[model samples]
Target chain A: MKLRALAHSRTGDKGNTSNISVIAFDPANYERLRREVTAERVKTYFAGIVKGDVVRYELPKVSALNFVMTETLGGGVTRSLALDMHGKSLSSALLDLDIPEGEE
Target chain B: MKTIRIGSGAGYSGDRIEPAVELAEKGEIDYLVFECLAERTIALAQQAKMKNPNAGFDPLLEPRMRAVLATCKAKGIKIVTNMGAANPLAGARKTAEIAKSLGLTGLKIAAVGGDDVIEAIRETPWPLVESGGSTTDLGNRIVSANAYVGTASLVEALASGADVVITGRAADPALFMAPLIHEFGWAMDDWDKLGKGTVVGHMLECAGQVTGGYFADPGVKDVENLARLGFPIGEVSEDGTLIVTKVPGSGGKVTAQTAKEQLLYELHDPKNYFQPDVVADFSEVEIEEIGPDRVRVTGGTGHPKTATLKVSVGYVDSYIGEGQISYAGPGAVARGKLALEIVKERLALMQVKTTELRFDLIGVDALHGPRLSAASEPYEVRARVTGRTDTLAEAVRIGNEVETLYTNGPAGGGGAFKSAREIVAVQSVLLPRDKVAGTVQIVEA
Candidate 1:
């Protein structure tokens, strides 16, 4: 199952770092997200765009996983030549990542 | 325990004023915060201030104040804003003048400043937060440097009997956190309480984001009345428990999902979310949908704050030149590609001194490149070329090359538009807390 099947995401940028949050639609799938949506997987997913490391922070209360990607965004918003300098569209792209469905 | 109600008026400089008016009139709030300054906004304002002595504040300040000042004054609801972009004194003076014209009496507006620490920063050799480059490297290109001050000065201003507080470059969450401190008398050193308050403030800082304004999708998320999306209001208690909601009759809803999305918006680390007052820890925070349009946020912790404050340093980075031309009907992708190729060749021939450039087909590969997009040709495409150059002449040439494509290449290319703009980029550096001092003075009309 795609990450979008169980979650919605939003992207924010500071300097060249892009922070994307993926929140589970249902808390039952939080464990599935925690298991499959690893930083390594996310780094591989955005292999070409993100130049540096990716770190994931977990929030079980909100059932959300925040992926902070360093050296992304083509540089910061004001300096970047990319069409979406802030990387706001990156969240939707991350939602396309596939994960195994968990039994309820 | 007593609780104070606070409303978020304007989220950004261009945010809608109608919702703010609704928040002031019907929200029954004690404080209304307007967060208008972006990272690079003040740098641009600094340029404007250089041109005109009294023109560095938010452009819509008067209009927004005109729309809400009367109701806010009548309801005894104080306002705190960072709309004083590059000039808080001028912003305070303008607010005072606006109040007098509106026949408002006893309206005390205060401006808190001393956040501009360019001179102080120049004395020290500090490395920037992102690039780790020395500050002296930028030299004459540096426009402004503002340290993100905390809520202490703002709290002092509120206590000094001011009805409105205008600030230049205080941290965003500090605006919301000040009211909680002022009303609850929460100790500045109380990390837990400050952390909880920061959570509420961060959630409301974006105004409509927490209230389902930006959470909508056509079918997947499905938020209603997003067109007239209502701003957020928080009922915060002395213990730092908060319930985020909106005006009852207003548009937009506050659900747990919305709260969760906002909770992590721009959040780098949940455990070490740094603010000037405290390094808040939202890792253990919890959100519960207590009622319709009411989400309860609690359980935020905090650690000791760093001795240094983060300063936003703005410099003249480059000039951005852009051009967009659309191609429709059959073979639009090929025409768009051809248009891009022509611009590339022209730019190389002209020897435009550009550091970087992008060629995007908007309908197809603007964002994802060709990797994610379909291999089949697109029926409609908009060819966009953006280049970054040091000189305006070089930048203009890049855009001019794209505009020339209408006649030179690519059949059916229409709606050719071009623009060249100076890019003011910003980076962060740490400055000792003692180097920057904040002062608050009430200006009366």
Candidate 2:
């Protein structure tokens, strides 16, 4: 079963934030979805997912890493709770990753 | 293995330090909470303030917190605490300073205030919740007060940025609940969900009390190796069901029955287990054993907050500075009482009037408290007495002459006079309608 990983990022002067999702089959391969997929992995990861800049914050004290995966989650501005195809695209990409199982 | 953690919530004294920490090393735990503020701490801190405003128990957190913080930080575990009494900002800063001193930066430090309005009583009117309590009748006797802030602050601290949240006054359940909220991102107004969260919080508030530290089933095997006992944890779900369990292969035992025993501990009524927001019906909170270590609990409710936030205030206060000349060789009790009588006569002759006069031998029934009352052995006793006076002159008269009993009264053990001076400080407590600020303006060292 696939779970949605929502990406949140800091944007603009006030540090406005955004979220995008990607399908994750397992937590292990989540690292490969982007170059340095971190609170800051958004800029590289969101290249095709969105058309904007991303700001990242590594707030480890809270054990959370935040990002600005802009244009990614915001393209569907007219609808609230809207699911953009960008996240769906990432999910589709993730759903196809071939698994080599040692089955540990 | 599923984890069960437990530790004393507020055995908040330096004396109770070793035992509380040793419970963990003797066992397994996902988390630990220490409740370090109680009426006695409030009283003690209040008295300390009179002598020197800031010269009080901040250091007390050192012994207990050091052991826990060092271990938890090293192991990447977490702690929720209210040892932040008097000044939490100071405590958090102190923690950060220690972290920096040890090259442990990025240690999330958060402080929750704005709930601690010491001056609230004089301004806003608190809508009466019950009739017998008019809140008005309480005149100056109110000293070293605090509001019951809930889990929201801890949740926010965990949300925004904090490896550790040092709070002033919050319900014990809040500490545990805040972590769950941070983990699940549970919304605040979700009463049913919050109810579920609170039930989990309630189960683990008392440390060892839940995990056989206070009570034991005679049938169970060795409870020794108590040095590292497992803490209790409630694996709660959104619907308010939880398993009260400890770490697998731990020092304590957990069963639906043992969990039930803990549920009854320190609580007045099972059906009416109360918190700030919920009149939690323990009857509603059901428990089941899913397996060896998991005792599941369910069915609880939460109400909207009556106050936006809670207020806790601490200030300088006075207490009966009492001491005794222990005359325990022989004829101790009788002579002690006689000496007390002489002090009374002397105070009366000297025109001394006080609010109260207490005379009782330490080993006798006059001494009452949670633990020491359990000591049944009789020993040489002091006729420890306290006389309150408005003026130090009058107070000094009683405090100064307490030693005269040695020469005049029939002495068994030699008597020595001790000081009886108390300091009283008043704090005006108020609940503000704002969340505490999480922004820390960094200072360049």
True contacts kept of 1: 0.82
Q: After superposition, how far is residue B280 of candidate 2 from its true place, in Å?
A: 2.7
User: Where does model 2 exceed 4 Å of error?
Assistant: A1-104, B1-30, B39-57, B63-65, B68-71, B124-145, B216-239, B245-262, B265-274, B287-296, B307-318, B327-333, B367-381, B414-417, B423-445
Instruction: Output candidate 1 Cα RMSD.
Output: 1.1
lDDT score, residue A41, model 2? 44
Docking class of 1: high
lDDT for each residue of candidate 2 in B234-347, tens digit (9 for 90 to 100): 555544556676656556667554555455433433344445555454445555668876777666666555544434333233334344677675566676677778877876
Q: Which ten residues in a row have the lowest lDDT in candidate 2 chain B?
A: B436-445
Candidate 1: TM-score?
A: 0.99
Top DockQ: which candidate number? 1
Q: Name the candidate that leads on TM-score.
A: 1
Instruction: Please tell me the interface RMSD, in Å, for model 2.
Output: 27.8
Query: Residue B140 of model 1: what lDDT?
Result: 85
